[model samples]
Target: MKTIFSSLFLAAGANAIITRWAPCCFHLSASGAVTGTVGQLDDGQNRVNGPLSPAEYCIADGAITDANGRGCILTPPTSQWQCDTGATPTSGFSVACDGTVAYNGGTTFYECQTGDNGEANIYLTPGGTNCGEITLKADGCGSCPPPPPPPPTTCPTNLNGNYEFPHLIIPIDSSNPNSAAGTSYFGEVSSTISSIFNFDIPASDSGKTCSLIFLFPLQSQLTTSSFTFSGNGAIDFSLLSGVATVSTSYANAPSVETDYGSITVAPGNSYNVATFACPAGEAVSFELKAVGDTCLNYFQDYNPSPIGVYITTC
Candidate 1:
Protein backbone atom coordinates (compact mmCIF):
# COMPACT_ATOMS: atom_id res chain seq x y z
CA MET A 1 0.00 0.00 0.00
CA LYS A 2 1.16 3.53 -0.82
CA THR A 3 1.03 6.07 2.01
CA ILE A 4 1.76 9.79 2.47
CA PHE A 5 2.07 11.53 5.83
CA SER A 6 1.15 15.11 6.68
CA SER A 7 2.11 16.79 9.95
CA LEU A 8 0.61 19.72 11.81
CA PHE A 9 1.24 21.49 15.13
CA LEU A 10 -1.68 22.60 17.30
CA ALA A 11 -2.07 24.26 20.67
CA ALA A 12 -5.30 24.27 22.73
CA GLY A 13 -6.00 25.61 26.24
CA ALA A 14 -2.69 24.53 27.86
CA ASN A 15 -1.67 21.60 25.68
CA ALA A 16 0.19 20.96 22.40
CA ILE A 17 -0.15 17.91 20.17
CA ILE A 18 1.39 16.38 17.04
CA THR A 19 -1.40 15.62 14.56
CA ARG A 20 -0.40 13.25 11.72
CA TRP A 21 -2.64 12.47 8.73
CA ALA A 22 -2.31 9.46 6.45
CA PRO A 23 -4.53 9.04 3.37
CA CYS A 24 -7.02 6.17 3.92
CA CYS A 25 -7.24 5.21 0.22
CA PHE A 26 -3.90 3.35 0.21
CA HIS A 27 -4.55 -0.36 1.13
CA LEU A 28 -3.40 -3.66 -0.40
CA SER A 29 -5.59 -6.75 -0.90
CA ALA A 30 -4.67 -10.16 0.53
CA SER A 31 -3.63 -11.25 -2.99
CA GLY A 32 -1.27 -8.24 -3.12
CA ALA A 33 -3.63 -6.11 -5.24
CA VAL A 34 -3.54 -2.30 -4.70
CA THR A 35 -6.88 -0.76 -3.53
CA GLY A 36 -8.48 2.53 -2.41
CA THR A 37 -8.12 6.08 -3.79
CA VAL A 38 -6.12 9.26 -2.98
CA GLY A 39 -7.47 11.71 -0.30
CA GLN A 40 -9.60 8.99 1.32
CA LEU A 41 -9.37 9.21 5.15
CA ASP A 42 -9.33 6.44 7.79
CA ASP A 43 -11.18 8.03 10.77
CA GLY A 44 -9.11 6.21 13.40
CA GLN A 45 -5.86 7.53 11.95
CA ASN A 46 -6.99 11.03 10.94
CA ARG A 47 -9.14 12.15 13.89
CA VAL A 48 -7.75 14.73 16.33
CA ASN A 49 -9.21 17.25 18.84
CA GLY A 50 -9.83 20.62 17.15
CA PRO A 51 -8.07 23.70 18.55
CA LEU A 52 -11.28 25.77 18.17
CA SER A 53 -13.99 23.62 19.91
CA PRO A 54 -14.54 20.50 22.02
CA ALA A 55 -15.42 18.37 18.97
CA GLU A 56 -12.91 16.20 17.11
CA TYR A 57 -12.00 16.59 13.43
CA CYS A 58 -10.20 14.65 10.68
CA ILE A 59 -6.87 16.14 9.40
CA ALA A 60 -6.30 16.19 5.67
CA ASP A 61 -3.91 17.91 3.30
CA GLY A 62 -2.24 19.71 6.27
CA ALA A 63 -5.54 21.44 7.14
CA ILE A 64 -9.03 20.83 8.65
CA THR A 65 -11.76 20.66 6.05
CA ASP A 66 -14.66 19.76 8.36
CA ALA A 67 -15.44 18.21 11.76
CA ASN A 68 -16.81 14.83 10.53
CA GLY A 69 -15.21 14.95 7.09
CA ARG A 70 -12.28 17.12 8.28
CA GLY A 71 -11.85 20.06 10.63
CA CYS A 72 -11.32 23.63 9.43
CA ILE A 73 -8.00 25.34 10.29
CA LEU A 74 -8.38 28.19 12.77
CA THR A 75 -6.70 31.29 11.38
CA PRO A 76 -5.93 33.64 14.28
CA PRO A 77 -5.53 37.41 13.98
CA THR A 78 -2.38 39.32 14.80
CA SER A 79 -1.44 38.98 18.49
CA GLN A 80 -4.29 36.48 18.83
CA TRP A 81 -2.28 33.25 18.61
CA GLN A 82 -0.69 32.50 21.98
CA CYS A 83 1.83 29.81 22.81
CA ASP A 84 0.77 27.25 25.35
CA THR A 85 4.32 27.05 26.68
CA GLY A 86 4.02 30.75 27.66
CA ALA A 87 6.97 31.55 25.37
CA THR A 88 7.18 31.49 21.58
CA PRO A 89 10.18 29.97 19.80
CA THR A 90 11.83 33.37 19.40
CA SER A 91 9.38 34.01 16.51
CA GLY A 92 12.19 33.71 13.95
CA PHE A 93 15.38 31.86 14.86
CA SER A 94 17.25 30.26 17.73
CA VAL A 95 20.94 30.91 17.91
CA ALA A 96 21.62 27.81 20.02
CA CYS A 97 20.26 25.58 17.27
CA ASP A 98 21.88 27.32 14.27
CA GLY A 99 24.51 24.71 13.39
CA THR A 100 22.38 21.63 14.07
CA VAL A 101 20.68 21.59 10.68
CA ALA A 102 23.92 22.23 8.80
CA TYR A 103 25.25 18.96 10.21
CA ASN A 104 22.64 17.02 8.23
CA GLY A 105 22.48 18.73 4.82
CA GLY A 106 22.44 22.07 2.94
CA THR A 107 24.91 24.95 3.11
CA THR A 108 22.54 27.04 5.26
CA PHE A 109 19.60 26.41 7.55
CA TYR A 110 17.06 28.00 9.90
CA GLU A 111 16.56 26.81 13.46
CA CYS A 112 13.82 27.58 15.97
CA GLN A 113 12.81 26.49 19.43
CA THR A 114 9.80 24.22 19.83
CA GLY A 115 8.92 24.97 23.45
CA ASP A 116 9.96 26.91 26.54
CA ASN A 117 12.22 24.08 27.56
CA GLY A 118 15.96 23.55 27.43
CA GLU A 119 17.83 23.36 24.10
CA ALA A 120 15.63 20.44 23.10
CA ASN A 121 13.05 19.83 20.36
CA ILE A 122 14.93 22.16 17.99
CA TYR A 123 13.32 22.57 14.56
CA LEU A 124 15.51 22.82 11.47
CA THR A 125 14.56 24.01 7.98
CA PRO A 126 16.94 24.17 5.03
CA GLY A 127 17.39 27.15 2.69
CA GLY A 128 15.75 30.59 2.75
CA THR A 129 12.12 29.69 2.32
CA ASN A 130 11.01 30.56 5.90
CA CYS A 131 13.14 33.64 6.38
CA GLY A 132 11.74 36.69 8.24
CA GLU A 133 8.49 34.93 9.08
CA ILE A 134 7.27 33.64 12.49
CA THR A 135 9.62 30.65 12.58
CA LEU A 136 12.57 31.76 10.41
CA LYS A 137 14.63 34.86 9.59
CA ALA A 138 16.96 36.04 6.86
CA ASP A 139 19.77 37.21 9.11
CA GLY A 140 19.03 35.40 12.34
CA CYS A 141 20.52 32.13 11.09
CA GLY A 142 23.77 32.10 9.12
CA SER A 143 26.64 29.60 9.20
CA CYS A 144 29.48 31.12 11.15
CA PRO A 145 33.02 30.86 9.85
CA PRO A 146 35.31 28.29 11.41
CA PRO A 147 37.75 29.42 14.07
CA PRO A 148 41.09 30.78 12.80
CA PRO A 149 44.20 28.59 12.84
CA PRO A 150 46.31 28.72 15.97
CA PRO A 151 49.43 30.91 16.05
CA PRO A 152 52.81 29.25 15.70
CA THR A 153 54.40 28.58 19.09
CA THR A 154 57.93 29.14 17.89
CA CYS A 155 59.48 32.02 15.94
CA PRO A 156 59.87 31.34 12.22
CA THR A 157 63.34 31.24 10.67
CA ASN A 158 62.19 33.23 7.62
CA LEU A 159 60.16 36.45 7.74
CA ASN A 160 57.92 38.00 5.10
CA GLY A 161 59.10 41.18 3.29
CA ASN A 162 59.57 42.85 -0.08
CA TYR A 163 62.89 42.08 -1.83
CA GLU A 164 64.26 43.43 -5.11
CA PHE A 165 67.30 42.91 -7.30
CA PRO A 166 70.29 45.24 -6.78
CA HIS A 167 70.32 48.30 -8.98
CA LEU A 168 74.09 48.00 -9.41
CA ILE A 169 76.96 45.48 -8.80
CA ILE A 170 80.35 47.23 -8.46
CA PRO A 171 83.57 45.25 -8.52
CA ILE A 172 86.83 46.54 -7.03
CA ASP A 173 89.00 48.69 -9.35
CA SER A 174 91.20 46.76 -11.90
CA SER A 175 89.10 43.55 -11.61
CA ASN A 176 87.56 42.46 -14.94
CA PRO A 177 84.34 40.55 -15.39
CA ASN A 178 84.61 36.74 -15.13
CA SER A 179 84.02 34.31 -18.06
CA ALA A 180 80.28 34.83 -17.55
CA ALA A 181 79.44 38.06 -19.42
CA GLY A 182 77.54 40.28 -16.94
CA THR A 183 78.45 38.55 -13.64
CA SER A 184 80.64 40.30 -11.05
CA TYR A 185 83.70 38.20 -10.35
CA PHE A 186 85.13 38.08 -6.83
CA GLY A 187 88.53 37.01 -5.47
CA GLU A 188 91.88 36.57 -7.31
CA VAL A 189 90.80 35.18 -10.72
CA SER A 190 93.98 36.75 -12.17
CA SER A 191 94.76 39.96 -10.23
CA THR A 192 91.75 40.11 -7.78
CA ILE A 193 88.17 41.23 -8.38
CA SER A 194 86.31 41.84 -5.14
CA SER A 195 82.65 42.67 -5.96
CA ILE A 196 80.26 44.87 -4.01
CA PHE A 197 76.51 44.22 -4.17
CA ASN A 198 74.27 47.26 -3.66
CA PHE A 199 70.74 46.06 -2.97
CA ASP A 200 67.89 48.57 -2.85
CA ILE A 201 65.64 47.73 0.09
CA PRO A 202 61.96 48.59 -0.41
CA ALA A 203 60.36 51.09 1.97
CA SER A 204 57.51 48.70 2.68
CA ASP A 205 59.64 46.61 5.05
CA SER A 206 60.79 49.64 7.03
CA GLY A 207 60.77 49.81 10.82
CA LYS A 208 61.10 46.04 11.15
CA THR A 209 63.86 43.57 12.00
CA CYS A 210 65.36 42.73 8.63
CA SER A 211 67.92 40.23 7.34
CA LEU A 212 69.69 39.68 4.06
CA ILE A 213 69.93 36.24 2.39
CA PHE A 214 72.27 35.50 -0.48
CA LEU A 215 71.48 32.61 -2.83
CA PHE A 216 74.22 30.83 -4.76
CA PRO A 217 73.16 27.88 -6.88
CA LEU A 218 75.78 25.27 -7.72
CA GLN A 219 74.33 24.61 -11.19
CA SER A 220 75.05 28.23 -12.22
CA GLN A 221 78.64 27.98 -10.97
CA LEU A 222 77.93 30.75 -8.47
CA THR A 223 79.90 28.80 -5.85
CA THR A 224 83.08 26.78 -6.45
CA SER A 225 83.26 23.72 -4.17
CA SER A 226 87.03 23.74 -4.82
CA PHE A 227 88.60 25.46 -1.76
CA THR A 228 91.20 27.19 -3.95
CA PHE A 229 88.61 29.52 -5.58
CA SER A 230 86.12 29.46 -2.67
CA GLY A 231 88.01 32.05 -0.64
CA ASN A 232 84.99 33.90 0.83
CA GLY A 233 85.72 33.50 4.57
CA ALA A 234 83.84 36.58 5.81
CA ILE A 235 81.60 39.26 4.30
CA ASP A 236 81.24 42.98 5.17
CA PHE A 237 77.77 44.55 5.06
CA SER A 238 77.18 48.31 4.79
CA LEU A 239 74.68 50.91 3.59
CA LEU A 240 76.30 52.45 0.48
CA SER A 241 75.20 54.89 -2.25
CA GLY A 242 76.46 57.52 -4.78
CA VAL A 243 78.28 54.77 -6.71
CA ALA A 244 78.88 56.65 -10.04
CA THR A 245 81.40 54.20 -11.54
CA VAL A 246 82.39 50.51 -11.24
CA SER A 247 86.01 51.61 -10.59
CA THR A 248 85.04 53.54 -7.40
CA SER A 249 87.49 52.39 -4.78
CA TYR A 250 86.27 51.34 -1.31
CA ALA A 251 88.85 53.61 0.38
CA ASN A 252 87.15 56.72 -1.02
CA ALA A 253 83.63 55.14 -0.79
CA PRO A 254 80.62 57.44 -0.40
CA SER A 255 79.73 58.81 3.06
CA VAL A 256 76.40 56.96 2.65
CA GLU A 257 78.31 53.68 3.13
CA THR A 258 77.59 52.94 6.80
CA ASP A 259 79.38 49.69 7.65
CA TYR A 260 77.19 47.34 9.67
CA GLY A 261 79.78 44.60 10.43
CA SER A 262 81.63 41.64 9.03
CA ILE A 263 79.71 38.35 9.07
CA THR A 264 80.80 34.85 8.14
CA VAL A 265 78.88 32.59 5.70
CA ALA A 266 78.86 28.81 5.97
CA PRO A 267 79.58 26.71 2.90
CA GLY A 268 76.04 26.05 1.66
CA ASN A 269 73.45 26.79 -1.02
CA SER A 270 72.28 30.03 0.64
CA TYR A 271 73.76 32.43 3.17
CA ASN A 272 72.07 34.62 5.78
CA VAL A 273 75.02 36.97 5.83
CA ALA A 274 73.63 40.06 7.60
CA THR A 275 70.92 41.29 9.94
CA PHE A 276 69.90 44.91 10.66
CA ALA A 277 67.11 47.09 11.92
CA CYS A 278 65.30 48.70 9.01
CA PRO A 279 65.12 52.48 8.95
CA ALA A 280 62.16 54.75 8.03
CA GLY A 281 60.40 54.92 4.67
CA GLU A 282 63.53 55.49 2.64
CA ALA A 283 65.20 53.35 -0.05
CA VAL A 284 68.29 52.12 1.82
CA SER A 285 71.24 50.65 -0.09
CA PHE A 286 72.76 47.36 1.13
CA GLU A 287 76.42 46.88 0.28
CA LEU A 288 78.17 43.49 0.48
CA LYS A 289 81.94 42.84 0.22
CA ALA A 290 83.69 39.46 0.32
CA VAL A 291 86.79 39.35 2.61
CA GLY A 292 88.81 36.49 1.08
CA ASP A 293 90.47 36.33 -2.34
CA THR A 294 88.68 33.36 -3.91
CA CYS A 295 87.72 33.19 -7.61
CA LEU A 296 83.91 33.25 -7.39
CA ASN A 297 81.23 35.02 -9.44
CA TYR A 298 77.68 36.32 -8.85
CA PHE A 299 75.94 34.68 -11.80
CA GLN A 300 73.81 37.43 -13.44
CA ASP A 301 71.22 35.71 -15.62
CA TYR A 302 67.81 37.38 -15.23
CA ASN A 303 66.19 34.31 -16.79
CA PRO A 304 66.33 31.88 -13.89
CA SER A 305 69.02 33.85 -12.15
CA PRO A 306 71.49 31.72 -10.17
CA ILE A 307 72.73 34.19 -7.55
CA GLY A 308 70.49 36.72 -5.80
CA VAL A 309 69.86 38.40 -2.45
CA TYR A 310 66.68 38.62 -0.38
CA ILE A 311 65.74 41.17 2.29
CA THR A 312 63.17 39.88 4.74
CA THR A 313 61.52 41.33 7.82
CA CYS A 314 59.84 40.07 10.97
Candidate 2:
Protein backbone atom coordinates (compact mmCIF):
# COMPACT_ATOMS: atom_id res chain seq x y z
CA MET A 1 0.00 0.00 0.00
CA LYS A 2 2.86 2.47 0.63
CA THR A 3 4.41 1.77 -2.80
CA ILE A 4 1.00 2.48 -4.49
CA PHE A 5 0.79 5.84 -2.66
CA SER A 6 4.26 6.76 -3.88
CA SER A 7 3.24 6.16 -7.57
CA LEU A 8 0.06 8.29 -7.20
CA PHE A 9 2.05 11.15 -5.68
CA LEU A 10 4.55 11.11 -8.52
CA ALA A 11 1.75 11.12 -11.20
CA ALA A 12 0.06 14.10 -9.53
CA GLY A 13 3.34 16.07 -9.47
CA ALA A 14 3.89 15.42 -13.19
CA ASN A 15 0.34 16.66 -14.11
CA ALA A 16 0.88 19.91 -12.13
CA ILE A 17 4.08 20.66 -13.99
CA ILE A 18 2.41 20.08 -17.43
CA THR A 19 -0.47 22.40 -16.62
CA ARG A 20 1.81 25.17 -15.32
CA TRP A 21 4.15 25.05 -18.34
CA ALA A 22 1.44 25.84 -21.06
CA PRO A 23 1.67 29.30 -22.75
CA CYS A 24 -1.04 31.98 -22.10
CA CYS A 25 0.01 34.99 -24.30
CA PHE A 26 -0.82 34.98 -28.07
CA HIS A 27 0.34 36.90 -31.22
CA LEU A 28 -0.56 37.41 -34.92
CA SER A 29 1.35 37.40 -38.22
CA ALA A 30 2.30 40.65 -39.99
CA SER A 31 -0.21 39.88 -42.77
CA GLY A 32 -3.07 40.43 -40.25
CA ALA A 33 -3.86 36.71 -40.41
CA VAL A 34 -4.04 34.84 -37.11
CA THR A 35 -1.24 32.41 -36.36
CA GLY A 36 0.14 30.20 -33.56
CA THR A 37 -1.88 28.67 -30.75
CA VAL A 38 -3.93 30.91 -28.46
CA GLY A 39 -2.47 30.80 -24.96
CA GLN A 40 -4.36 28.74 -22.32
CA LEU A 41 -6.68 30.75 -20.07
CA ASP A 42 -6.47 30.34 -16.30
CA ASP A 43 -10.13 31.15 -15.84
CA GLY A 44 -12.30 28.20 -14.79
CA GLN A 45 -14.58 29.03 -17.77
CA ASN A 46 -13.24 28.05 -21.26
CA ARG A 47 -13.48 31.60 -22.68
CA VAL A 48 -10.17 31.78 -24.78
CA ASN A 49 -9.37 29.47 -27.69
CA GLY A 50 -8.85 29.13 -31.52
CA PRO A 51 -8.47 31.92 -34.12
CA LEU A 52 -9.30 35.50 -33.02
CA SER A 53 -12.01 37.46 -34.93
CA PRO A 54 -11.25 41.04 -36.19
CA ALA A 55 -13.75 42.57 -33.75
CA GLU A 56 -12.45 40.55 -30.79
CA TYR A 57 -8.77 41.35 -31.31
CA CYS A 58 -7.20 44.33 -29.61
CA ILE A 59 -4.77 45.87 -32.16
CA ALA A 60 -2.33 47.15 -29.53
CA ASP A 61 -1.92 43.73 -27.93
CA GLY A 62 -1.42 41.87 -31.21
CA ALA A 63 2.28 41.01 -31.71
CA ILE A 64 3.12 40.78 -35.40
CA THR A 65 5.31 38.00 -36.76
CA ASP A 66 6.22 38.25 -40.44
CA ALA A 67 6.32 35.27 -42.86
CA ASN A 68 10.09 35.15 -42.33
CA GLY A 69 9.54 34.73 -38.58
CA ARG A 70 10.71 38.26 -37.88
CA GLY A 71 8.94 39.75 -34.83
CA CYS A 72 7.15 43.12 -35.20
CA ILE A 73 4.61 45.28 -33.43
CA LEU A 74 1.05 45.31 -34.80
CA THR A 75 -0.64 48.74 -35.28
CA PRO A 76 -4.30 49.64 -35.77
CA PRO A 77 -5.92 49.42 -39.19
CA THR A 78 -3.89 46.61 -40.67
CA SER A 79 -5.22 47.43 -44.16
CA GLN A 80 -5.76 50.65 -46.13
CA TRP A 81 -9.36 51.70 -45.60
CA GLN A 82 -10.76 53.50 -48.63
CA CYS A 83 -13.88 55.66 -48.60
CA ASP A 84 -17.07 53.82 -49.41
CA THR A 85 -18.51 56.62 -51.56
CA GLY A 86 -15.90 56.03 -54.22
CA ALA A 87 -14.95 59.72 -54.11
CA THR A 88 -11.42 60.32 -55.34
CA PRO A 89 -9.19 62.46 -53.11
CA THR A 90 -7.59 65.46 -54.73
CA SER A 91 -4.19 66.92 -53.97
CA GLY A 92 -3.81 68.18 -50.40
CA PHE A 93 -6.39 65.69 -49.16
CA SER A 94 -6.22 65.52 -45.38
CA VAL A 95 -7.86 64.23 -42.28
CA ALA A 96 -9.27 66.50 -39.60
CA CYS A 97 -8.83 64.14 -36.69
CA ASP A 98 -6.14 61.70 -35.53
CA GLY A 99 -7.26 58.12 -35.90
CA THR A 100 -6.27 54.76 -37.34
CA VAL A 101 -6.49 54.02 -41.06
CA ALA A 102 -9.71 52.11 -40.46
CA TYR A 103 -11.58 55.34 -39.63
CA ASN A 104 -11.48 56.59 -43.25
CA GLY A 105 -15.14 56.61 -44.35
CA GLY A 106 -17.07 58.76 -46.81
CA THR A 107 -19.36 60.11 -44.11
CA THR A 108 -16.92 60.45 -41.22
CA PHE A 109 -14.56 63.20 -42.38
CA TYR A 110 -13.95 65.75 -45.16
CA GLU A 111 -11.15 65.50 -47.76
CA CYS A 112 -9.98 67.68 -50.62
CA GLN A 113 -12.20 67.23 -53.68
CA THR A 114 -10.59 66.15 -56.94
CA GLY A 115 -11.56 68.99 -59.36
CA ASP A 116 -12.15 71.77 -56.83
CA ASN A 117 -9.37 70.97 -54.43
CA GLY A 118 -7.32 74.12 -53.61
CA GLU A 119 -4.38 73.34 -51.42
CA ALA A 120 -0.62 73.65 -51.10
CA ASN A 121 1.80 71.16 -49.69
CA ILE A 122 3.97 72.15 -46.79
CA TYR A 123 7.11 70.61 -45.33
CA LEU A 124 7.41 70.51 -41.56
CA THR A 125 10.64 70.56 -39.62
CA PRO A 126 12.08 67.84 -37.36
CA GLY A 127 10.37 65.11 -39.41
CA GLY A 128 7.06 63.59 -38.48
CA THR A 129 4.38 61.25 -39.89
CA ASN A 130 1.87 64.06 -40.26
CA CYS A 131 1.91 66.04 -43.52
CA GLY A 132 -0.50 69.01 -43.96
CA GLU A 133 -1.94 71.32 -46.60
CA ILE A 134 -2.65 75.05 -46.95
CA THR A 135 -5.23 77.08 -48.86
CA LEU A 136 -4.50 78.37 -52.36
CA LYS A 137 -4.38 82.15 -52.57
CA ALA A 138 -4.82 84.46 -55.58
CA ASP A 139 -1.59 86.16 -54.67
CA GLY A 140 1.07 84.07 -53.05
CA CYS A 141 2.98 85.22 -49.99
CA GLY A 142 5.86 87.71 -50.44
CA SER A 143 5.30 88.83 -54.01
CA CYS A 144 7.79 91.45 -55.12
CA PRO A 145 6.51 94.95 -55.83
CA PRO A 146 6.67 96.26 -59.39
CA PRO A 147 9.95 97.91 -60.38
CA PRO A 148 9.98 101.67 -59.67
CA PRO A 149 8.94 103.82 -62.61
CA PRO A 150 11.76 105.34 -64.65
CA PRO A 151 12.77 108.84 -63.68
CA PRO A 152 11.00 111.66 -65.54
CA THR A 153 12.76 113.48 -68.33
CA THR A 154 13.33 117.21 -68.25
CA CYS A 155 13.07 119.59 -71.23
CA PRO A 156 15.82 122.00 -72.31
CA THR A 157 15.29 125.75 -72.15
CA ASN A 158 15.17 127.84 -75.32
CA LEU A 159 16.60 131.35 -75.53
CA ASN A 160 15.48 133.29 -78.57
CA GLY A 161 14.68 136.90 -79.55
CA ASN A 162 12.97 138.99 -82.25
CA TYR A 163 14.54 141.75 -84.37
CA GLU A 164 13.55 144.57 -86.76
CA PHE A 165 15.12 146.68 -89.52
CA PRO A 166 14.52 150.44 -89.34
CA HIS A 167 17.17 151.81 -91.70
CA LEU A 168 20.03 150.85 -94.09
CA ILE A 169 22.09 152.97 -96.50
CA ILE A 170 23.67 152.07 -99.90
CA PRO A 171 25.13 155.18 -101.58
CA ILE A 172 25.47 155.41 -105.38
CA ASP A 173 28.37 157.71 -106.21
CA SER A 174 30.83 158.28 -109.09
CA SER A 175 32.94 161.12 -107.75
CA ASN A 176 36.61 161.35 -106.72
CA PRO A 177 38.22 157.89 -107.09
CA ASN A 178 39.33 157.90 -103.43
CA SER A 179 36.07 159.47 -102.16
CA ALA A 180 34.73 158.42 -98.68
CA ALA A 181 31.29 158.93 -100.33
CA GLY A 182 31.14 155.14 -101.11
CA THR A 183 30.75 152.19 -98.68
CA SER A 184 33.77 153.41 -96.67
CA TYR A 185 31.85 156.51 -95.50
CA PHE A 186 28.90 154.34 -94.29
CA GLY A 187 31.02 152.73 -91.52
CA GLU A 188 31.49 156.09 -89.76
CA VAL A 189 27.99 157.11 -90.69
CA SER A 190 26.52 154.07 -88.88
CA SER A 191 28.44 154.91 -85.69
CA THR A 192 27.11 158.46 -85.66
CA ILE A 193 23.48 157.42 -86.39
CA SER A 194 23.38 154.81 -83.62
CA SER A 195 24.48 157.49 -81.16
CA ILE A 196 21.67 159.87 -82.19
CA PHE A 197 18.38 158.13 -83.21
CA ASN A 198 15.95 156.80 -80.53
CA PHE A 199 12.39 156.21 -81.79
CA ASP A 200 10.07 153.78 -83.63
CA ILE A 201 8.95 154.71 -87.16
CA PRO A 202 6.71 152.77 -89.51
CA ALA A 203 8.31 151.17 -92.58
CA SER A 204 8.57 154.27 -94.70
CA ASP A 205 9.83 155.36 -98.11
CA SER A 206 12.40 157.56 -96.30
CA GLY A 207 13.79 154.52 -94.45
CA LYS A 208 13.64 152.26 -97.57
CA THR A 209 15.06 154.85 -99.94
CA CYS A 210 18.01 155.67 -97.69
CA SER A 211 18.67 151.98 -97.13
CA LEU A 212 18.70 151.25 -100.88
CA ILE A 213 21.00 154.15 -101.78
CA PHE A 214 23.61 154.24 -99.02
CA LEU A 215 24.50 150.81 -97.60
CA PHE A 216 25.21 151.69 -93.99
CA PRO A 217 25.85 149.03 -91.32
CA LEU A 218 23.93 150.11 -88.24
CA GLN A 219 23.04 148.33 -84.93
CA SER A 220 22.21 149.06 -81.26
CA GLN A 221 21.90 147.18 -77.98
CA LEU A 222 18.42 145.78 -77.23
CA THR A 223 16.60 146.46 -73.99
CA THR A 224 15.16 143.28 -72.45
CA SER A 225 11.70 143.48 -70.86
CA SER A 226 12.26 140.30 -68.86
CA PHE A 227 14.80 137.56 -68.40
CA THR A 228 14.30 134.09 -67.06
CA PHE A 229 16.38 130.98 -66.41
CA SER A 230 15.62 127.37 -67.26
CA GLY A 231 16.20 124.29 -65.12
CA ASN A 232 19.39 123.66 -67.04
CA GLY A 233 20.74 127.02 -65.86
CA ALA A 234 20.11 128.65 -69.21
CA ILE A 235 18.98 132.28 -69.46
CA ASP A 236 16.24 133.38 -71.93
CA PHE A 237 15.32 136.90 -72.88
CA SER A 238 13.35 138.97 -75.45
CA LEU A 239 14.53 142.30 -76.71
CA LEU A 240 13.18 145.19 -78.85
CA SER A 241 15.11 147.95 -80.56
CA GLY A 242 14.60 151.34 -78.87
CA VAL A 243 15.70 153.39 -81.86
CA ALA A 244 18.72 153.96 -84.17
CA THR A 245 20.18 156.66 -86.43
CA VAL A 246 22.69 156.21 -89.22
CA SER A 247 24.15 158.63 -91.81
CA THR A 248 26.58 158.41 -94.72
CA SER A 249 28.44 161.16 -96.72
CA TYR A 250 30.39 160.74 -99.96
CA ALA A 251 34.14 161.31 -99.61
CA ASN A 252 34.05 163.69 -102.59
CA ALA A 253 30.70 165.47 -102.06
CA PRO A 254 29.18 167.32 -99.12
CA SER A 255 25.86 165.48 -99.63
CA VAL A 256 24.80 163.14 -96.80
CA GLU A 257 21.88 160.77 -96.24
CA THR A 258 20.75 159.31 -92.88
CA ASP A 259 19.03 155.96 -92.29
CA TYR A 260 17.48 154.22 -89.28
CA GLY A 261 16.75 150.57 -88.32
CA SER A 262 16.09 148.13 -85.41
CA ILE A 263 17.14 144.59 -84.45
CA THR A 264 17.31 141.98 -81.57
CA VAL A 265 19.93 139.68 -80.04
CA ALA A 266 19.63 136.72 -77.66
CA PRO A 267 22.48 134.52 -76.53
CA GLY A 268 21.96 131.13 -74.98
CA ASN A 269 20.80 131.77 -71.44
CA SER A 270 22.71 128.81 -69.93
CA TYR A 271 25.96 130.68 -70.48
CA ASN A 272 26.91 134.30 -70.14
CA VAL A 273 26.12 136.19 -73.36
CA ALA A 274 29.57 137.71 -73.05
CA THR A 275 31.62 134.70 -71.83
CA PHE A 276 29.42 131.83 -72.99
CA ALA A 277 29.80 128.93 -70.57
CA CYS A 278 33.50 129.13 -70.02
CA PRO A 279 34.90 126.50 -67.66
CA ALA A 280 35.89 127.61 -64.19
CA GLY A 281 39.63 128.07 -63.53
CA GLU A 282 40.15 128.56 -67.24
CA ALA A 283 40.81 131.72 -69.29
CA VAL A 284 38.07 131.89 -71.89
CA SER A 285 36.79 134.58 -74.30
CA PHE A 286 33.65 134.91 -76.39
CA GLU A 287 32.94 137.04 -79.49
CA LEU A 288 29.25 137.98 -79.60
CA LYS A 289 28.13 139.46 -82.90
CA ALA A 290 25.11 141.74 -82.94
CA VAL A 291 22.69 139.87 -85.17
CA GLY A 292 19.24 140.36 -86.73
CA ASP A 293 17.71 142.26 -89.66
CA THR A 294 20.36 144.98 -89.40
CA CYS A 295 23.19 142.47 -89.58
CA LEU A 296 21.45 140.67 -92.41
CA ASN A 297 21.16 143.85 -94.39
CA TYR A 298 24.82 144.70 -93.82
CA PHE A 299 25.83 141.26 -95.05
CA GLN A 300 23.52 141.44 -98.07
CA ASP A 301 23.92 144.98 -99.50
CA TYR A 302 26.88 146.77 -97.94
CA ASN A 303 30.54 146.38 -98.97
CA PRO A 304 32.46 144.10 -96.65
CA SER A 305 33.17 145.94 -93.35
CA PRO A 306 34.13 145.04 -89.75
CA ILE A 307 31.47 147.20 -88.08
CA GLY A 308 29.10 144.27 -87.48
CA VAL A 309 31.19 142.39 -84.93
CA TYR A 310 30.05 142.93 -81.31
CA ILE A 311 31.20 141.34 -78.00
CA THR A 312 29.84 141.03 -74.45
CA THR A 313 30.59 139.05 -71.22
CA CYS A 314 29.00 137.07 -68.43
**Which candidate leads the pack in TM-score?**
1
Q: Which candidate number maximizes lDDT? A: 1
TM-score of model 2 vs. true structure: 0.13
What does candidate 1's lDDT look like per residue over 34-70, in tens digits?
A: 1111111232121111121222322222232323443
TM-score, each model? Answer: 0.36, 0.13
Q: Write the per-residue lDDT of candidate 2 for residues 65-106, one digit (tens) a residue.
A: 222222222112221112111222111111112211111121
The weakest ten consecutive residues by lDDT in model 2 span: 1-10
Q: Each candidate: RMSD to true structure?
A: 17.5, 35.0
Model 1 misplacement above 4 A: 1-161, 174-192, 220-229, 241-252, 255-260, 264-267, 301-306
